[model samples]
Target: MTEIEFQKNFSQLQYHLYTSPLPHVSNLHPHQKTIHAFFMLDHLREELQRKNESTLKTVNAKDFNLPEELHVYHSLYPLDQRQEKSIKIFGYPSWVYKSVCSVDGRVYCLRRIEGFRLTNEIAMSTIENWRRIRHANIVSIREAFTTKAFGDHSLVFVYDYHPLSQTLFDKHFSSSSLQANNHPQSGGTGVVVPETVLWSYITQLASAIKTIHSSGLAARMIEPTKILSTNKNRIRINCCGIMDMLTFDGGKNIHHFQQEDLIHFGQLIISLACNSLSSVLNLPKSIDYISRHYSPDFKNVILYLLNKPTPTKSVDKVIAMIGPRILHEINSVHHYNDFLESELSQELENGRLVRLLCKFGFINERPEFDMDPSWSETGDRYLIKLFRDYVFHQVDENGYPVVDMAHVLMCLNKLDAGVDERIMLVSRDEQSCLIVSYKEIKNCIDSAFRDLSRRK
Candidate 1:
């Protein structure tokens, strides 16, 4: 039936039900109600198809198989692949067929499923909308296809293959316990990595969300598992692929993008930070120390729950207390600068002391160390070790290792040799010891190390 006629019939059915005297409409037979609901849903789908057809028609079939140069960044992964054997992955239902493709020498995932018939036009429109959106964190779509067979339909979406990256839940919650047990020294340490690394991930995640917001789209799903990172600096978000699936089934109802995205984004941040804190502090899952301390609203919710008259009052209060403490521990550097200054100073003091061979024009305006000082203690240790290895060479002094003037000048050419730029500057005459700055140190260390690694 035509969309309008179907809608009219569905509305008439709804009107009859609403006008019935029985408040509880359970008197209807189970099979009859089931059939009624099924037709109503079908009619709604038809109406949506009619409404979205014009927009979908604008999406050309040729766009799906565009040449490499003509394809957008999101379409690159899907277009370059030579289809491989089907595989099953977690998260999705078992019925969905999956394949792997090598695009630009990188593996990309392609999922094909039948039963949910999507028009080529609709698929193309979704791809087009995705192409215009750009974010550092969000994974770009590679390509999409739709096919129809005798009464059966299938849709395929191509996406960049992120190796060694799992959903946040998989990474933090599922794997952390096993990792903590197996590699107690590294992963089991109560300390998290430096704020720099954590902030790097957070900033990328926020930027991705911001991009989605700007594109007039909302990432309905924002969680750890959706956030992906390789060993490299790049982070890829898997929202577009999931959103495409939802839109294919007429589930894209984003009337309030900002509100919904913001809520989800907040939840994502809270979840990650909470999980990190729980792992590091050995706290329960529900207690989010970081959010409770940083977010007053969340804190209030916890407090209200704790105030309930129950035997678990003490336990609830303690859990509530844990969240704030985690937040405090992570963010405590904001209130005090001594810890960072001392740590940076110690790194410079221990590393090789590079004296100015000849007084070249040194700037009157010194370097700035304005970045956040609050880093996980483990991060501090890594930075220290990084300085010793790349920037400063250890020397034997009176039968003991010491960093002195000679070591500094010898390491001058090697200054900033590592990724963590922590350097030690000394005067040629060995009189002045001016710690240049942590920022300069990290830059010098990183550069020197990077160049050395590249040479090898």
Candidate 2:
């Protein structure tokens, strides 16, 4: 993805993580929650600015305190927004980040915790235990250190950045006309998911869970949104490790909760086939449509997983039931394509980028129709507006985003990075005119948003 597109997607991801309704948080009034959310956002922006502006010097072992400092760069995006809310990792509510390592110019993901009164011994021991875990499907915490650099008591654990993603939620909920309006089981005029694909996804995920189970760990959240799809028909579970911290609430080990994980996984499979979870568990008969499309064997396995009374089966057995792929090989490959255009979609797409860029003074076309993208303020703004207006849809004031990141990323990937067009910028504050190229403006927009957002 282009830098601009990645920032957009990152913004959307933060929106999802932040807007997740905390209905259980009854103590705070609605306005208070909104205020708190914005406050948390400010904290995130400030921390990001500090990290971005600070000089990232190399680590010195003799004089270096890994806890105090280890030159971290390009981690301007703060994963934590609402500090008042306890976000969990493996059951521990901690902050997480996508960071660039100054030492080796490699990117990494880190989980953060305000280590208030936390001891290094406990932190190191936890990190060591996590490093011992070896699972292809599960993300493991590799390195850790304590730092008061940002504030009081901050413990950070770093992990590899696995960006392979197309959340299970989007795979089913995407605006692709075929997937949206054509699921046969969902009464759409389309065939149900190929048995091969369904079985493949389940088999791969089952193996991953099996490994975690063997290690005596349960992926507490196994729903569609929490799972990520990668190359080779693989799906990795995300947002783990903090469930126990949340569920246990520092109380005690809860073994039966593991069964809850199994139950959630079964629901995921059903949702995948059915397309929606409307009256699923209450009426076991709701699953009849699945049987109609899939084979009796497939239906039976799904029913067994969904049926609680029947003895729970292991992942190995689940795979055994759907033994080797004998038929229906999928030779067709999938690619991200969102280029198709509709008036509403185009308007929505343009509106967001237009208004957003206009706020930054990048738009100078007077907001009229029949305008060429290059006529805009800069190549960056011109290209951004052109792409947005032509490709994506406009969202309502309070509406959630309808355009998917895959679509944005796909369109961005097709762009000619070498193309450069110049545009003039007359700053509103200074009225000073400056000649700049599209590429330069596009790169500066992220920093502009960061600086402007803080002022707001």
Candidate 3:
């Protein structure tokens, strides 16, 4: 029989045998065991063949086409007006065509191949996993299509388009001549700003990283460039690290290599924090810090072994040099202050002080303030009036509002307490500030006055 016919017949036979229940076997002679092993090999080969055939059929380029009735949602530019540009997939052996989606007008990255050796079931499982994961930080998978084009099967994974630009690394390392101070443009319409927008981008990225960690998955490849800031304060994290490295023959011992991802994440955080600090301090930009700071711990060790000088390259060192510690301390204190403020706000929202403070013009009325009711029902109008009264009339013997801790706490307490109670504080300085509501102040003062009267 020809090779093709032999393969087909062998596949058919193995499929039947493997599907059948295993025969009970006693201790067999070497020859019998060899025969059994041969059958096992045949079964495995047939299974592999089936898998390859399934993959080839699915990836056939002819099977895929743009779906009709494509709905446009959140396109950066006019879908009908934007020109479609094709990008060649460099370094990949597969023929992939990437174009902007006319329906959504987002960049649609497509991988089209004549054949693949991955099974349809495997592909389906991967897609299913992708669908289950949803986060503001993660790029949403809009749709996937498998269709035939000119007798060739094709598969496409559709993701929300994120405009690509010079990654943080590219921007930092590329030749100075290519560096222009113009607002860096990305996406189709070039409406997004990169420089003035990085703070929100960094925050969104941290939130996304937090989400990923909560999902029991480590984002292995977290670098500045891999993070894209989408419209509406959302961020898309590219290069997810949850892939099976072994499946792609990308590495050995996939489980052990996960530590590399942890180091990378730490490096990313350090870089983001340092950059933010530098910008805040109005310091000159420097790439040396980022590069030296992000060098893998193992790489630093290797350099030491090779008798090469290595910088103090660790996240801890970078954090120490930068103002992260001071920021951390301040944030912790601020968070505690916010907690106290929230408590005061809840009390005010419950109308505990409505009767006591209304005489002082500190009534609860809905105001044109941005404070959310979900955050605090003490109406913005009430807070604003209370703040103004406290600023003007409330002062201690030394001319300081009695309520002062942090901004949030100070605002809430002064609002809940009448301006008359504010006279107890010595000064606005944190050390002399007393963060207490009107009720607490009244009880303390009333008790003091009664004690004085009895002594008299």
Candidate 4:
């Protein structure tokens, strides 16, 4: 028999492998599983791409009349939505901006304390302590410096930027929450945070305070407005070193400030639980509400923190009291980690197929090789061209375009695996056809790509 005839016979045998039915592996429907997995991977990819775009995104400095540069940072984009409600937490009209660091090409959040002149260099050094203290629930202080880029003596602090993060205040206590509270049709229950989420916040805050106190610093600003809700039930303390700089004295009562941190932490929890900032103002009412709503252990923990200041009343004590609850938080974290890992694994094959498709793009329809009469549509390249049409450019019998993602995925997977399974590829004109194995097609792709690379 001729070599061409032998090849055609072998292709026919390989094609049977695909045509043959296989036993069910599991009870789960294959189509349903494939659809769910593909869609989830696509969503994750799109979200990651969006975050990446936001990170590298630059603003037109001229359009916004923004400063061309502030030391090593540039591309200043205001992170604050409402410039009208300026923050006075740092005892100055503070503005938030998202900027890119020219030195390392990293996006950072810049908290600019407007019109604040640094009289004491030691106050600048206060940020160094905060810079040293790092915790998962803290928005890490990078550096603080005074700049006149905003046409004022602005104290600008650089922090790690978390894209699409909302503050706890905005997430839970914004106009929506207020409107819900004032809704006449409903009772004044207001928007109550879930108990599990509240415990998560408590454990996280306790952990953060422990880190800060251990580093000889205090997180004086622990309110909802200063805490970022980066993800579902995930909170991080923002603007850590601002108060330290603004409230600078030559000598600080570190112990007293540490005690105050405990007080503020208690108030923060009470505020979240009551769903109102005013709840903290009336201590007895807040405690009574907590007693009525939350567990006894929660109320007791709050009472311990809100008690009179003593050297023994530290974050370590808080951690000790709520040690069992901490286990729940860590367990929740591990479960979430597993979920993300599963989601990530689903995208592994998609990434490989994307690379394979890219190779096809480079090798097929080459204008440079078009000059050569025997280039594409002649040999191995012809098979690849037909395979491309089989994979992406399919049509139904009625002449309508067929958009079958499952078919595309299956073909790509087979090609990537370089299986011995064979398929028939038809020419676009329907005048020619070829029976080829995926292994052979994969070889053709690699050969074509290599030739193109060497030519380049």
Candidate 5:
């Protein structure tokens, strides 16, 4: 996406998230607030897709034109044999490419299905059904269009892309260190995934399933390749709408497919635990090993999901077994560039970022006069800009990112994105002066007495 378009979409997302939500309640838990923000964003996505439908009608799939906002990145391809095979199946060759939604500045995956016979009706209907879904743990669909192929029309689906995403299957089983750690007797105790992170993934997947089931949808695509691990060890179910669309003309009941989804999900969970790709073939042994290493509760849950009869198994039951978990880390992006973009946008919208910074004590160490109401507006503004730089930009003489304010804004300066967002500080002087906020500005007019009391 171009800089201008990205800034616009980024600003809109910020307004939705950082603002005091629609009803304006301040006491909501962080979980409630984030869920609400995700809901609003999901609703926004549905609305955009409806508007896109009209424009899509103007072109036939055989001679479709690439509209202005969707720029296809033709040069990107599968980096390895696994990826190539995954995107290409049944002897037909196809691939996924990167693209930018000039409209939203968000990166999207454009997967070309070479030989599918999708009537315009099925494509639109499938997209419409998918668009209504808004779960935070699901990879969202932006748009779907058809293109002309040599023998048929190809259906191309656009999906949200996460930077640095790797399949859960590859994450645990592909690496030597991880492989050795999962089998501790190998004498190479490598980086074992924290128990916290494993539990976190399990609970999040349960949440995603609950959301999907609530929508009366079955996620038939539940294998490891279809699950993506994002920054901060978060796992998201990918391809929410694809399998349903593929079966749109197949005449099978969705519930049948939904039950299959549960089967695969159970397989996926056990695969992670056992660190084996050929999980189903060793079902009995897998259960025995998991029972040996994990708790009785988890073992019971896995048995119910995989070995039990489908007529009796339940997702809610599994979730009840795993119980409740906090989802704050799932919402974060890992790359430094993404951090700066998300943080800078959060700060611009009504000072919640600044409020968070203050709560974390990054803004408490400023010079008294700069924060004092007696200072002229110009002086206060100058100090405020400097303080913003120090908190979000300045580095120490040791060449390390400062560790203040949750290390979010402070750490952004540690990467290349910092050069553009930060004030280009010369040295370490302003780290002592990070205090700044909109609260003080509001105090200048709304409550003089309050400000006077703060000073004392």
Candidate 6:
């Protein structure tokens, strides 16, 4: 068989395979799965379009007292609702803003440390080392520089922007009790995060820390507020390399810092488990809570990280303990990949149909072609006109419009595939008719389009 014929048969087979009812599986209708997949893709398209539009939208710079330019970045908009003095983490009152990079026209998250003086010029060089560190769970830092545009001496660090992302603290701890109270999984005790989800977080954090330590650097900040949830259960370590720049001492104690990273990692997890940042203060109660709620492996992982600093205690040890959990996370990732590929296939089909429709819109009902008034009314072009009417301008016996979407889709699909199925095309006057196959109409469209393009 020809390629077109083979494709047509294969498409039919695939449709049947997806839609066919199976007695062994369950009692489901033939078209249920197909319709669900179609609508799921439709919703996904809408979500993606909204996100893209939101990212591309620019706010009025005049509305706020914003800087016109800051080292190749412009159009700065404050991400925080209120510019409260938050000196807990960075020691300096920091502000986050979304700005467009003038050089590349891409948006980046600019973290400005307000009134931070550059005591040592070597501190700025630490960002270069961070620029080399890239991992899936780490929000890669672009660059850092000092600017006086904000009416003060400010140190700015550029990082990638994830639209509509929330901090781990904001999503979980800030309103943990409310979410847990409303959640069906939580039996109303509040702050009941699932053990599996905690495992996922543990594995992802370990992976990121391993990458950081391997690059001869350390993730000095690993708090809930410093991590962002870009999507559901998907997180990335935010504000990396800022501490190194802020606390730049001439003598470097990489080992001590790395050990502090482990301790902080353990405390973050404990705080998340106990549903309070103060959980680290009372280790006995927190350990008892973890013991009662979580598995032994999880408890052991926490215990290992919370232990006193030693020569052998490292992120590698944590990884070795959670080996099977890491495997489970990988398996989940593979399943998610499969689901995305299936959704992507549906989108590919949509893109093809859109192109086909665009081609029809370009060729059909031309007012004039090659300066010939009767060009579209004569020869093969006339057949295309009749085919358009057959697809869209259909009427019933009572002269009422028949708005059948299924018929329109079927005709378009057949035309795109160039199938051998023939149909009768009637003129506007109803005095003449011509029989032709989709394959012939397809050739007519190509020939007419090519003929039009060769002009001038």
lDDT of 6 by residue, 269-329 (tens): 9887777777788899888988888899989999999999999999999999999999999
Whole-model lDDT per candidate? 0.44, 0.53, 0.40, 0.81, 0.55, 0.82
The digit string of per-residue lDDT tens for model 1 on 310-365 reads: 43332223334345444654464454356445434534633343322111112111
Taking every candidate in turn, the Cα RMSD to the unseen true structure, in Å, is 27.1, 18.9, 28.9, 11.9, 15.3, 9.9
**By summed lDDT, which 10 consecutive residues of candidate 3 come out lowest?**
73-82
Tell me the lDDT of candidate 1.
0.44
Assess candidate 1 and give its TM-score to the true structure. 0.38
lDDT string, candidate 2, 67-138, tens digits: 333446444344333445443334344665566777887767676655543533533443444467766666
- The parts of candidate 3 lying over 4 Å away from their true place are 1-115, 143-154, 162-178, 181-203, 218-225, 231-234, 239-258, 266-456
TM-score of each: 0.38, 0.47, 0.32, 0.87, 0.54, 0.87
Candidate 6 ranges with C-alpha deviation above 4 Å: 1-43, 176-191, 397-400
Task: Estimate the lDDT of model 3.
Answer: 0.40
lDDT of each residue in 236-273, candidate 3, tens digit only: 77545324311343334433333343355444443343
TM-score of the candidate numbered 2? Answer: 0.47
Ranking by lDDT: 6, 4, 5, 2, 1, 3
Candidate 4, residues 307-401, lDDT tens digits: the string is 99976788889999999999999999999999898987766677898899899888777756736856766678888999999988998999898
Q: How accurate locally is residue 77 in candidate 1, as Cα lDDT from 0 to 100?
A: 23
Candidate 1 residue spans exceeding 4 A from truth: 1-107, 147-153, 175-197, 232-234, 239-241, 248-252, 276-288, 291-456
Give me the displacement of residue 343 in model 6, in angstroms.
Answer: 1.0
* Evaluation by lDDT, superior candidate among 4 and 5: 4
- Count clashes in each candidate, considering only residues at least 3 apart in sequence or on different chains: 27, 22, 16, 0, 0, 0
> Which of the two, 1 or 4, has more TM-score?
4
